[model samples]
Target: MRIGLYPGTFDPVTHGHLDIIGRATALVDRLVIGVAINRDKGPLFTLEERVEMIESEVAAIADRTGCEIVAHPFENLLIDCANDVGAKLIVRGLRAVADFEYEFQMVGMNRQLDNTIETVFLMAEAEHQAIASKLVKEIARLGGDVSKFVTPAVREALLARVGRA
Candidate 1:
């Protein structure tokens, strides 16, 4: 069985993320959504909350796409997480050249850690190239509706996290 790892902070899962997940699922037997716990970049939601949000979003997607979603929190290196999950591939979504630069560096680092695991980059849909969790949070915090960008669970979670409608 081919397994792929999709790692990200996922402050809140957005529709763009769902799109990537849906697309990535077609390339692998199972997709593990790894939530990286980054202390350097403070997150709007806690790890548990992020995991719950991912689970909710994944469950909804699975209902529609018939794909299996697994959520995990990783405080260690991403390569280590992939090893732990027995995944041989890391799936990433590329929004632009900027995203490629960062993801390329990560891919190299992961390759250094484990030469067997490979990173696969998928281009994000044109409409979602500019959608990011930080931007979503900023817009939602400023009273701008992000219902179109994120899933309903994420929208509610963001509203409760920021204490707004």
Candidate 2:
């Protein structure tokens, strides 16, 4: 089975992230959404919260995708998680040149860690290209609406995280 791992902090899985997940599903028989644990970045949501958000967001189309979708937390090296999950490809979403540059470096490192697993990049659709988790949180923290960027559940989660909900 062809398995692809889409790894991210997914602090609050935005629409752009979900879009990439949907598209990534089309390229593999199974897509595993790997929620990375990065305490150094001080994510607003807990690991469990992030996993639940991705799970909730993806559930809408999981049944019709022709691909199995599962979200899990990864605490170790990403390549190790990919290997453990039997992922032959590491899926990444690039919003623009900046994203591509960073993702490119990571892809090179991932390849060095395990040459057998390849990295695939997906460009974000124009409408959702500017929506990022960091910006989403900032908007919510400042009492702005993030409904357009995230699912209803994730929007609520973000508000609650900042004691606004």
Choose the strongest candidate by TM-score: 2
TM-score of every candidate: 0.95, 0.96
Model 2 segments beyond 4 Å from truth? none
lDDT of each: 0.89, 0.90
Q: Against the hidden true structure, what lDDT does model 2 obtain?
A: 0.90
lDDT of 2 by residue, 48-157 (tens): 88888888789876787878999978889999999999998999898989999898888889889899999999999999999989999999999999999998888887
Worst 10 residues of 1 by lDDT: 60-69
Cand. 1 TM to true fold: 0.95
Q: Write the per-residue lDDT of candidate 1 for residues 69-165, one digit (tens) a residue.
A: 7999999988899999989999999998999999888888878889999999999898888899999999999999999899777898899889995
- The collision pairs in model 2 are none
* Stretches > 4 Å off in candidate 1: none
